[model samples]
Target: MSEWFYQESQTESFLEREFVFANFLEAFAFMTKVAILSEKNDHHPDWRNVWNKVYIKLSTHEANNTVTDKDRNLAEEIDRIL
Candidate 1:
């Protein structure tokens, strides 16, 4: 939700969010949860992790990598994972 930002450019649009954890283990656990959610929803996210921080971007690949309802819904679900 409020923590997520919408990013757009000439070629793509996506919902972006960053999460910081107390340690790398916590961050990895968060990513694991997200992975499960992605599989259940059949919507994957582009993400990167470094130490205690994880950055994520969500978009619909079939929709030309643009932000869509699917992205929004998945973002909401991601919020709940916290």
Candidate 2:
């Protein structure tokens, strides 16, 4: 997706993006919202939050940790969450 960056390792590929919030609480709230949606869609993200920033990475683990349509779709949904 336009908002994400593509990354690859020797054995895996993923899409990554970053979001910044006004404060830690705001960022945590956003992450909670994303977690619920991820569970509902059965597609969880690899993510971390520090202070006001949330970094997210998406990949389909069942697909050998590669980026797939599932990752793209999830990325779009995550954007909507923002």
Candidate number with greatest TM-score: 1
Candidate-wise lDDT, in order: 0.96, 0.93
Candidate 1 local Cα displacement, residue 21, angstroms: 0.4
Off by over 4 Å in 2: none
Candidate 2: tens digits of C-alpha lDDT, residues 1-82: 6879999999999999999999999999999999998998899999998999999999999999999999999899888877
lDDT value, candidate 1, whole model: 0.96
Count of steric clashes across candidates, in order: 0, 0
User: Could you tell me the lDDT of residue 49 within candidate 1?
Assistant: 100
Report how far off residue 27 is in candidate 2 (Å): 0.2
User: lDDT, candidate 2, residue 39?
Assistant: 92
Candidate 2: residue pairs that collide: none
Write model 1 residue lDDT over 41-81, tens digit each, in one string.
Answer: 99999999999999999999999999999899999999998
